[model samples]
Target: MTGEPVLLTCDSGGVRTLVLNRPHRRNALDAELWEALRSALVDAGADRSVRALVLTGAGDAFCSGADLPKRPSTAHPLHRMRTLTEVTLLLHELPMPTVAKVTGVAVGAGWNLALGCDLVIAVPEARFSQIFARRGLSPDCGGTWILPRLVGLQQAKRLALLAETIDAGEALSRGLVTWVVAAADVDAFTDDVTARLAAGPPVALAQTKALLNENTDRTLREALAGEARAQAVNFATADAPEAYAAFAEKREARFTGRWAVPTRTEDDA
Candidate 1:
């Protein structure tokens, strides 16, 4: 953490929000910001108090992209790419869910960064674009891989090929964002969503996220088997039994065991 902290960090309730603080630059990612973000993400993942994480930016913009002016000055391109790949993996593999709160432009790698999260909530002012082609560069930060998986191949192609910007409503219509709200409602909507996720059964939520990620790469038979195994493990948890009892008693389930991450019986086999 250097250069005036690189980013802003705030923890409220059980949610940790990392806001990209370089508002003057529209939250452009320089090497320092990337490193600081990775460190912050690691710390948040390790903190048991954090039930969910939010990635946003200061000012109106979520992120414009990687710092374009510094690209030519970067000495180790391959190393930087590797670091970014690790960061993406970390976001995907974190035990807690992540939500990207986008109120303004999210372009190039910035768009990819938001895609890396589990969910995205955007305001009416939000804009998404794949600007690599416009810059005479191919997709970086796994944008090519993640975008198609998100909004399908054709839509991804249209955006990446033309480097066109799409507004929030169009993003929602294209399934690019999980939720869309009015510009003024972005903060409230993000807080509400994060609060709901934080209040969920931590163990189950983690398991569900893992299962969804795993199933994305699994065959039908494998997915069914994996679902059964996951269900069996969930059924054995204390929370599961409590849930059943409460349901039978016609009341909300009071799960006292918080943040109980279930061990995976097997890797993605």
Candidate 2:
């Protein structure tokens, strides 16, 4: 609210919520909005206190897509497109968990933005479409990379090629969205999910997210090695000891968000 009219940011209970504020244009991504969004994501990534992020829209629609001018701009198109690419990659690579709360239409780049999140929860009436083809362009915003991974190659092609709008139920069935609930229940559901994520051990959750995100590209041996390394790192964190203590005491573990991986000494070796 303090910055541009395009985005509104709020923090509560270790969760940072970024709401797209352009309601009239259905929260479409303009150049300025894109820059603001990237800045916000970067800040969230750097803030250790921010355990989770939620992306939503201020109005009924999540986002309509890019707000292109009727005539071509003098500015370089690829430069602008690269900005969007940066935003998508930042969101995908951010250490903390991210969730997209979808309500109305999430189309083209907008839909892809939601797909970039670690989890997406939508209302029953929410709609989604890969509408770039209809605009005489192919999908960007990491849509090509994420869609096939989520719904398989054939389905990815069909959805992109057809540019058809599908409701939240179909999106859930196709693995595009993690969950779908009634419009009335979306707020409560999202709150519960994000709260749980926020309370989770930061280092362990981050390590798990990194492992799963990269698992598809690594060999089994490499994955096993990576898992061992991640476990070693986890064991060095204060949360690891807290987890054990809590298990013994039958109480919830308190994580301080401290990530200190101890150095190995000759004695340990």
Candidate 3:
């Protein structure tokens, strides 16, 4: 908590929340902050107890993209870009669900980071922009890839080219964000959504997320095969049995994050 940590982390009810802590620069990503975020995400992916993750900013703005270094740096610029790539991929491919809680401005790499999450919950006053063009830069952090997939190639091109700012309602209509609520309700709504995700079966949710994410790259036959495999894997987990038992007992299932399936003996096989 000391020494002005660039990222803040908190865990509650199986949800791990990561807040970008650079409010003075609108939570901009500096080299140190980028590395810190990458490490935090990698750790979260490996932690079974962290059933879901919520990402947000400390102040009014979610993020304003990368901070401009005041002077020429000794380090190669591409190194930072490479790090951003790794961070975005980690967010996209995390096993558990990830949510972005966006309030104020989310522009450039910041907006792309939100897009990388499985879901985004934004307040009505939230503002978003693919501001790379305005900055004389092309999109990075998987913006080019994710934007086209979410909003179609033409719309993506227009947004990327124009660099026009859009409000939360427009973002929701364009499929840029999952949900938009009043600023006053954002905290309550995000908490409810994250809690629901945290309470779900971890293995099943992970499988579902993987299946959907890979769908665009897969043929129909391949997709079906993948679904079959995913379902088989889900069935092997304790959660499947727990769900059936819960159904019979007319009660909620208690998922324990136990995914290991017992090895079958010859007789059982």
lDDT of candidate 3 at residue 181, scale 0 to 100: 87
TM-score for candidate 1: 0.90
Give the Cα lDDT of each candidate. 0.85, 0.92, 0.93
The most accurate candidate by lDDT is 3
lDDT (10s digit) by residue, model 1, range 1-269: 34576688999989999999888889999878899888988898888788899999998899999887633654577876877887788888888889999989999988989988999999887888999998899888778887888888998889899999888889998888999888777788889999888877777788789989888878999999988887776766678878889999999887544434666776845
Over 33-146, each residue of candidate 3 has an lDDT whose tens digit, in order, gives: 999999999999999999999999988999999888999788886875789989999999999999999989999999999999999999988999999998899999999899
**Best of the two (1, 3) by lDDT:** 3
State the lDDT at 99 in candidate 2. Answer: 97
Task: Per model, state how many residue pairs clash.
Answer: 0, 0, 0
Compute the lDDT for candidate 2. Answer: 0.92
For the record, the alpha-carbon RMSD of candidate 3 to the native fold, in angstroms, is 1.9
**Which candidate, 1 or 2, has the higher TM-score?**
2
**What 10-residue stretch in candidate 2 is worst by lDDT?**
1-10
Candidate 1 ranges beyond 4 A from true positions: 1-3, 256-269
Cα-based RMSD of candidate 2: 2.5
